[model samples]
Target: MPSAIRFSGVSRHYGNVKAVDGVDMDIAEGEFFAMLGPSGSGKTTSLRLIAGFEQPTAGDIHIFGHVAQGLPPYKRNVNTVFQDYALFPHLNVRDNVAYGLMVAGQAKAERYRSAERALDMVALGGYGDRKPSALSGGQRQRVALARALVNEPKALLLDEPLGALDLKLREQMQEELKSLQRSLGITFIFVTHDQGEALSMADRVAVFNEGRIVQTGTPEDIYYRPEVPFVADFVGSSNVLPPEIMRDIRGVDAYGALRPEAVRRCDAGHDAWVRNVSFLGASTRVSMQVHGVAMTMLLPRGAEIPAVGSTIQVCWQQDDLHVMSR
Candidate 1:
């Protein structure tokens, strides 16, 4: 399938700082692709480049097979939902959503119809007349989304769209946005610092660091078989042991990463002494000293929580170990 958005060797700079460096990506048509990273990792910069808000200092950008490099923001078939929603406070929900169409010189009836359909699509039906100040944060966000979707853009560019919402509302909107993308079948390029959000929503995620993409894969691929130590440690919590490769079987470094869950608590047989036990609601996180190195293990709920300073055997199968060079 032809990609809806593509970036080839894209880079952007602010004076001496390379905000986005050598990013190459292909966002498939109708795919929910997320760029995940920490602050200053260039995810937002990449999104801005795609939206034509910023021009790449090197390389090129293409949207639906057309070179999008020199095109202005409005000329590109993309709409952005920013962190603040960027709604017009003076306009009602309907008017805010209809503004884009109206600016494009669409007829009043056609603009209203498009706005109404978009509002309905976002479950904000009949909210056209409500002012932004009268709406909740989630509702305002919906209005922003409706405004973006009403244009029927080729792709939606989201830069931390849910960052302002509280945790519960953020999760709720995450689900709503994912469902909306699937229903609409439009490409989505989302930028976020939240690993959980990207893991939950993205069809495939590109992990960025210091202006470059470190890894790109499905959530499971990134979580279970991270190609680099940064990808493994950043994506989820894991016991990153600095063990020498004692063996290599089937291309896996046999003596490397051991997920906390993979190490089971056995009778005092293995060489480990428990140092601490943290209650994590559904499971207990056990920190232990193994061969003079600190390690952790996760025991399932209802399992006996080991006492601090107790001797316990921590055993893991070879397959559970993910070996990556430091």
Candidate 2:
């Protein structure tokens, strides 16, 4: 498949500060891609650069084989959904959704028809006449989404689109957004700092840090086989074991990474004292200390919860060990 978005040595700067520094990446057409990182990590800057909201200080950006350097956001074959929703308070849901079409001078009747369909796509049917303030946070978010999708852009750039909603609503919208993306089959370049959102929704994810992409891979790959220490620590709450401890476990002198799921209770293995057990609804998080090294484990619900200060044998398979630095 051809590239939907491509960046070649792209850099954006303000004075001496580099927001996006020499980043190169490609998002295949119809792929659901995510840019993930902490605050000031440059993921949002990269998204804005793609949307033509921010120009590159150096290098070039391409959208569907066309150079996107000088094109205005309207000229590009994409639309953006910001964290704030950016919906017009004065307009009803219908007009807010049709705003883009109206700007393009689309026929009023036709735009309204498309707006209704778009609203229905976001499960907001019959919500046409409601004012922005009348809707809940989730509903207003759908309105913002409907507005963006109504334009039928080739790709969608989302900058923390789910940031404003409560947890349950955010998760619901995540699934909805994923389903919508699959149905539309358009490239979705989503920017988010949430690991669960990125892992659960994206076909592939690019990990950003300090204005650079440290690693890019499928969700499983990013989670199970992080190549860098930052990625291992950031994507999920991983235990980065010291080289000596890793060598003792794996017979190799290298930094080791293990997910919470990797460490498990066993009948025969190294002994550790359970420090704390946190009940997290569907799972129990176990914090233990082994040979003076603190480690965390995630056990599924219904498992016997070890009491605090109790000693237990824990073991992990060789396959679960990921050597991050050698």
Model 2 residue 23 CA deviation in Å:
1.2
Candidate 1 lDDT over 1-326, as tens digits, reads 88898899999999999999999999899999999999999999999998888999999888999999999998988999988999998888889999999999999999999999999988899999989999998888888899998998989999899998999999999999999999889999999999999999999999999999999999998888777767777886666665443342235443366677888966554578889989999898988997677788889999888889878777777678787654
Runs of candidate 2 with Cα error greater than 4 angstroms are: 301-304, 310-312
Residue 99 displacement in candidate 1 (angstroms): 1.1
- Candidate 2 lDDT over residue span 1-326, tens digit each: 89999999999999999999999999999999999999999999999999999999999899999999999988997999988988899999999999999999999999999999999988899999999999998998889989998998999999999998999989888998999999899999999999999999999999999999999999998998888878888997888888889777788887788899888888999899999989999899999998788899999988889999999999898888799842
List the candidates' TM-scores in order.
0.93, 0.92
After TM-score superposition, the amount by which residue 185's alpha carbon in candidate 2 deviates from its true location, in angstroms, is: 1.0
Error of 1 at 263 (Å): 1.8
lDDT of 1: 0.87
